[model samples]
Target: MDLECSDLFEWHMQSGHGKVYADSFALFISIPLASLCVLILIS
Candidate 1:
């Protein structure tokens, strides 16, 4: 049971990191697109 818990914790940590990275990448892409949209609207 201890080993299982440890494995689960490690998996969760890895998945959490991946989720954070994906969120960051999405935000990075979105900022440029958002700026472009704002510019278009202004024009």
Candidate 2:
């Protein structure tokens, strides 16, 4: 199990840093919209 996990992790790390930027962009946009919806519901 440990070996499998390590292999998977290595494969993921090799995939490149582009995914990190894309994920961060999605998170940045989603967090504010999610918070706004929550605030509207509370009000």
Candidate 3:
């Protein structure tokens, strides 16, 4: 029972880590694109 719980916790942590990494990557891509769009609009 304890082992099963630990495994589940680890799995959840891994999934959460993946989500966080993907979110940051998306933010990085979006921020640059947004900045470029804003610059184009100003120009």
Per-residue accuracy of model 2 over 1-43 as CA lDDT, tens digit each: 9999888767766789757856888899999999999999999
Candidate 2 lDDT trough over 10 residues, lowest sum: 9-18
- As for candidate 2, its clashing pairs are none
Q: What is the C-alpha RMSD of each candidate to the true structure, in Å?
A: 8.7, 5.3, 9.1
Error of 2 at 1 (Å): 49
Query: Which number leads on lDDT?
Result: 2
TM-score of each: 0.61, 0.58, 0.62
Segments in model 2 whose C-alpha atoms lie over 4 Å from true places:
1-15
Better of 1 and 2 by lDDT: 2
lDDT of 1 by residue, 1-43 (tens): 9999888766855885867766788899999999999999999
For residue 38, what is the lDDT in candidate 2?
A: 100
> Which is better, 1 or 3, measured by TM-score?
3
Report how far residue 36 has shifted in candidate 3, in Å: 0.1
lDDT of 1: 0.84
lDDT of 3 by residue, 5-25 (tens): 888767855885867766788
Best candidate according to TM-score: 3
